[model samples]
Target chain A: MIENFKKRFQKDGIWVLFLLPALLIYLVFMAAPLLDSMRLSLYTGKGYTPTEFVGLQNYIDLFTNPVWRERFLGALKNTVIFFAIHMIVQNSLGLFFANLLSQDFKGRNFFRTIIFAPATLSVLVTGFLWTLILNPHWGAINQTLKAIGLDSWAKPWLGDENLALVTISLASVWQWVGMPTVLFLAGLLGISDEILEAARVDGASSWHIFWKIKFPLLKPVVGVVAILTFVDNFNAFDVIYAMAGAKGEPGYSTDLLATFFYRTGIAGEHPIGIPNMGMGAAIATITFVILMTGVLIWLYSSRKNEDLV
Target chain B: MSRTQKLFTYSALSIWAFVAIFPIWTLIVNSFKPQKEIFSNPFGLPQNFTLEGYKAVWLKGNFGTYFLNTIYVTVISLALIIFFGSLAAYALAKWNSKSSTALYVFFIAGLMIPIRLGTIDLVRLMQFLNLQDTIWSLIPVYVAMGMPISIFILTAFVKNLPREMFDAAKVDGASEWRIYLQIVVPLLRPAIATVAIFNMMKIWNDFWFPLVFIRAEESRTVALGVSLLFGQYRTDWTRALSTLSLAAIPILILYILLSREFIKGLTAGAVKG
Candidate 1:
């Protein structure tokens, strides 16, 4: 067997042997499932019943029907809101912390570790922790607010319709801020020390160094981070499900597309015993399209820039 | 740095640190308090702090079983990722061919498409294979899901390595397998570690897979188990808090301990991509 493999390798057969197994598994499990879901979306039927070719009816109903349209648009609006807040808060704070931590200061590592800790845990754990901390009846957030003479500011953050989604986004931003911060920091580190020294010798302040010199150079990394945040936020389910739940509770205030799909397509109390697999697949397809479009646009621009470079 | 700015910087960092960690701190402190007292004064120490919450959650909540199950799934999935991912990555990195680009794209496709999209069929497939309610079911799913990114990163890292190393090995009449196993594998330690740590955190934190696939008591990961505990006692914040603490302690400690490697992996992965 070993001699035979030596012959095959001499004949340039190693790539075939190496790539086959992984590709086979990915094709079967990943590509097949994705394609199968799209195929499933083309058919509509009740649970355990025979199905017929519905063609584009499902897509039409999704966009045209009032109830589905309202909920779908609502989820879209809420998701956009979630992504917007994260882009502003998460990225800005990430840049701020990255800048601050990059400075020569005592206990910087300690602060970095502490700040990055939430990013390590599952969104589930962080969501649960914040839920506990913001429990209106017994949460420390309310306690602190009361202590600071802002007692009226406290509410059941996860339960209030007005605050639930924003609160959940903030929780997500907290868990994921470390990622963009680290990305920005890497970009910061890549800037030459001599360049910074040159800037410093020219009498530029630290703020000027960052805004004028460092920020523009960090644009590529920031672009990558922004697109990542956008895609992840669009598909974000774990934090919302963990905090607000599958129905996107508190009057469906926190209902993003992912959770809405889970409820409508995957896990809700379908009147029938079987799930609405097609409707769920439709939701998943929409999410996939939106996310892939965002990613492809980013990649296209980045590739063009790389070519110019 | 000026003296005033130095002091101001340290002070700002400290305040942010305190704010960043306050939620978990609150969870620990509140876990000891009785349910009645939690609502009254959540900020202060309990008048009669006790071990009742922890004791109840540990014994009644069955966190031990959940922890063991989580460990089994995470460790096995990570092992599969390292072994299978590196082999594929070796071929993709070393063998520059038209097919390798396609193979790379094939794997890259898996990254953009989230695995949950196929839930309708995946659940059916799992049931057909009799893997529902089993921890083993998550292994292939995770391996397949994680393969693309791992291979992508590993290929990039390996491509960056000096070409002379592989040449040196081959000049010694080393077999292809020998070149990969002996030379390439050793050199890939940091990349493998980065991939392992990244995948480990993700696998441990995953909740949707367990909720969708595992229905039995022995199959539940910590995240799923904690969610179940929350469901059981929706109004019982103290018990839920205790369960949360049990779930969070190990991960939080691991984060603090190896944050440098974790951050390095994260930044490299993000920036390069």
Candidate 2:
């Protein structure tokens, strides 16, 4: 039996070697941390120093406790607002640009390149750039507004609780609209020109053709972009963290879920020095579940559509 | 094709083109103006066009070093992704059975799952491996993170490769390894280029990885270095604008020169779903 086992190991050794690196990396890094975070979420304490087996108490507090509950719901509302703004501004603008550029024009390539340029820059860079532009006191935007006799419109966009989230979301939209535009453009190109010509022959208006024909054909690609937007918007951290800092603050106005988790986990309670890894982990777990549900629903819908077809 | 509709389309395209190009133009023009002019008349051309900002940015910031570091990381990562990624993809594609399908799914699962979820443990693992605060730490992570998407694209391309080439190679007593290197690799050039461009832009522009992993200023990539510069001084518009223009110019020139291929690659990658 020993000899047979040794021979089997020797024969399979190369495959084992080939698989070792990826498996080791994934297991050590991906799987273990996720599991650990989930495990951490079950334990609770005053802070980082856990002393009790709370067993979903953190989650319970999240839902039941007013202080935590309000914060949670507020962040959720802001996130929804953020996402709604992006869908309207980013996706709609992307569709508009895609529609415009679908028809040939001089320097079309150059236009595409410039339009997509912001997407290539890091969001951190883009965020900082816009923050400077929108700075209330010394911003070029205000200066331009004043120069053009529109000075009344200028405000501390990032410093106002009311405008901070909206302003930041618009900046995010500007940086990312290129992505969906290109995706939509690709979808447009995939559509047969002959069908569009047929619509033309039928005396359909351009807007009518776009709404009735191309829009329906582009549903799958649109679905993909939507899910992508969903995942990315939820995972968003760097831009907000860089621009608004961890609290999403102008008095916690922009406090996103990711930032909230970060503050609780690592930065600690400002008044308190202790970190609450367990609670943070619980929040992270909830966030992950929400994201996973979104993804799974998307996959199921796509698969069901395929089955029907 | 109605005249009025055509006119509207052209007008819309023109307006968008203006909007897109305007910010870039503003950055460039702003970089050439002195700080006072920039603040006083934000919209006009520079009163006295100067290279002083560029001179200052290059001399003081050591942007050259940042540029070199970015290029090194991006190029090396690209080579690895194209090579190992393609090799693994070819195996997954050619095996064409239940086990390979499982492996394919295993690799592609990394797509839906964000790598940041594993970030805590990854940092610890990097520390344990003693790769913290180093460029080497980024390479493997980037490669591993990038593999699934690269494989997905390359596999699609591989599936479309002409079968006769493989058949001919097989008839000449070529092994699978030989067929992959000799026959398959060359035909994959366009797809590989497409993949390379997409990955290059991601690496060159990434800030999160650098912010988390690279602690030393000496180790900073262009994106991180420039951001650090911005952070140090809150209201230095002249220098900040200089830095922004510096970061953008190289990529701008690249995009302008290869606009067609670059846009093609982007649209192709995105719409593939």
Q: Write the per-residue lDDT of candidate 1 for residues B158-208, one digit (tens) a residue.
A: 898899999988899998888889988899999998898878888988888
Off by over 4 Å in 1: A1-10, A48-50, A270-273, B37-41, B44-47
Chain B TM-score in each of the candidates = 0.93, 0.95
Residues A1-309 of candidate 1 have per-residue lDDT tens digits of 999989857766876777777777677767888888888787777642216678877778789999788888889899999999999999999998888888776788878888887788778878877777777866677877887999899887887899998988888888888778888878888888899999999999988999999998888998888887887788888888878877778887888988878876667444553667788778888888888898889889888887887
Candidate 2 per-residue C-alpha lDDT over A232-284 given as tens digits, one digit per residue, 9 for 90 to 100 = 78778777876797788798888777777766764577878566767877877
Clashes of each: 0, 3
lDDT of 2 at B266: 75
CAPRI quality level assigned to candidate 2 from its DockQ score: acceptable
Could you give the DockQ of candidate 1?
A: 0.70
Q: A-chain TM-score in candidate 2?
A: 0.91
Q: Model 2 misses residue A13 by how many Å?
A: 8.6
Q: How many residue-pair clashes does candidate 1 contain?
A: 0
What interface RMSD, in Å and to 1 decimal, does model 2 have?
Answer: 2.8
Candidate 1 pairs with clashing backbones:
none
State candidate 1's TM-score.
0.95
Candidate 2 local lDDT, B23-122, one digit each (tens): 6677778889888887776767999777787787778778888898888889888888788777766766666556668877877776676666555445
